[model samples]
Target: MYQVALIEDDIEIAELIKNKLNNIEFLSSIDIYEGPLTYLNSGKKAPIILLDILMPEMNGLNAIPILLEYDPDALIIMHTIKNNSETIFQSIRSGAVGYIDKQSSNIDYTKVFRSILNGGAYLTPNVAYKIVNYFQTKKNQFNSLTDRENQITDKIVEAKSYKDIADELNISINTVRMHIKNIYGKLQINSKYELIKLTKSR
Candidate 1:
């Protein structure tokens, strides 16, 4: 059995989740906090933390790092109504291991907790679809580029000069410039900074 901490500003919702967690066999206990500040002040560490995004004190996104700092081993899961791709991706980038949509009807506390405990991740079906779609879109964007254009994109992302790329590819500098221009067009990016951001996001 594992202890869990839930940080949500809504008292009613917090109690609801706590009741559901109470029924999970793997969970030994559940502590509900009205906000991140209360949880952080408590200095209590749990193996799993269910966090809500919108709160009067501090948003869950910003609280993620602080919570992790307090207990690096805690598996934080975003339990919120916010299901947009940007928020989902941002939560993941901020160190959350799972994203659960509060409105998802298929939430199985047992399965979710078990999966995370066994070194896996959990995402609501809609959330998972959004993540998959994002990668597919990124893939399609790359696929639109020719093989040579793709190569030049990599070189540019590596901070290589146009002349150096030309020397390595055995092409003239102007040819290298042309390929880069095509890459930028295909990727719909204006500069190396954007190119780097796009690639890193993938």
Candidate 2:
């Protein structure tokens, strides 16, 4: 069983997220902290920590290191509305391995939990886009993509679904997915969000 901790100030949002986690099969318990100060003083730890960015007391960005100091193994995932590149990079720099948008229309709980369970990283499409854009401006090292892969990537950045990309490119849906998988492998990213991010950056 996995223990999960949530440090969020918004009562409604906290409850909503808590309920969502409750449905997960592996999660045994959840502890909610309204602020960083309380979370730090509680001496409680969990394998996974879902933290919010804005709070009345100590914000999530500042709390990342402190949580790690308390428990070095804790996997912190920034669960927030802030999708800007700077904040996303700051969270990663501060120690968060994953960033999820609470405001996204579709939040894949299974993918999120599976990523964390596998010790991998998950980034919402918007957040991933910013990171891709940032790196694209710094250095264009991902020039190995094939032309078909590039076409699919462009459609992805435009927020097209697999069916849309396949239809537009006169290819099968499996072909589109295959190109996306190849793109992810070449770019060292996991989700379509990250792929879209990279395409938009280009």
Which 10-residue span in candidate 1 carries the lowest summed lDDT?
177-186
- TM-score of model number 1: 0.82
lDDT of 1: 0.91
Best candidate, TM-score: 1
lDDT by residue (tens digit), candidate 2, 1-202: 9988888999888898889888888889878999878888888878899999889899889889988998999999999988888899889998898999889877887689789789789998888888888787534546778888777777788888899988898989998888888888888889987766656655
Q: Which stretches of candidate 2 lie over 4 Å from their true place?
A: 138-202
Which pairs clash in model 1?
none
In model 1, what lDDT does residue 22 have? 97
C-alpha displacement of 154 in model 1, angstroms? 3.6
lDDT of 2: 0.85
lDDT of 1 by residue, 1-202 (tens): 8999999999999998999999998789999999889988997888899999999999999999999999889999999999999999999998999999999996988888888999999998999999999888888999898988888888888899988999999999999988878888888889889889998867
